[model samples]
Target: AQSVTQPDARVTVSEGASLQLRCKYSYSGTPYLFWYVQYPRQGLQLLLKYYSGDPVVQGVNGFEAEFSKSNSSFHLRKASVHWSDSAVYFCVLSGPNAYKVIFGKGTHLHVLP
Candidate 1:
């Protein structure tokens, strides 16, 4: 079985400050990890993904995530956030080559200037 848990339902960050989002998951074997961002009344966009290779992977918009096999966690980090970065961040995962992704509840991020 594969499942994801996002502890924080909402997060607020000041502009130009670093941000870190917590995420934990449970999977049987090699898991596919992904992070997505959704803007107001918009669709989700891919932030990053991790498969088999390196544990740390970078994505667009200055986003990155680290995969841990022992902890079964993939946490997202941003060096500096902007006001436009406010939105919902979701940690998603899929079973080994299942092609079906399961989305977490999501965390709403509010960026203040």
Candidate 2:
């Protein structure tokens, strides 16, 4: 079975500060990793995903994620975050069979101006 973990329930950061959201996964092999964001009253929107080829993929806005097989982690990062980026981010995983998708609890990001 595959699962994702987001240790932090909430994070607070300045509007212009760089942000890194931690994501740890448990799986036998590399799976399809994704980062999704959900606003207060909206659905999940994909930020970025890493399937194959490059270990890192560029996502919407300034979001980027790196896949580490050794650590079994896929952490999301942003060079500079804006106030609008405030939302709940989820780390998702799809197994090689692609039959199921597992979502993390989610990390709520609060940006202070």
TM-score of each: 0.94, 0.95
Off by over 4 Å in 1: 97-100
Q: Which number leads on lDDT?
A: 2
Compose the digit string of candidate 1's lDDT tens values, residues 1-113: 67899999999999999999989998887788899999988999999999878899999999999999888899999999999999999999897466667889999999999
Error of 2 at 29 (Å): 2.8
Q: List model 2 lDDT by residue over 1-113, tens digit each.
A: 67899999999999999999999999887688999999999999999999888888899998999999888899999999999999999999997676778999999999998
Clashing pairs in 1: none
What is the lDDT, from 0 to 100, of the residue 40 in candidate 2? 92
Whole-model lDDT per candidate: 0.92, 0.93
In angstroms, the error of model 1 at 17 is: 0.8
Candidate 2 ranges beyond 4 A from true positions: none
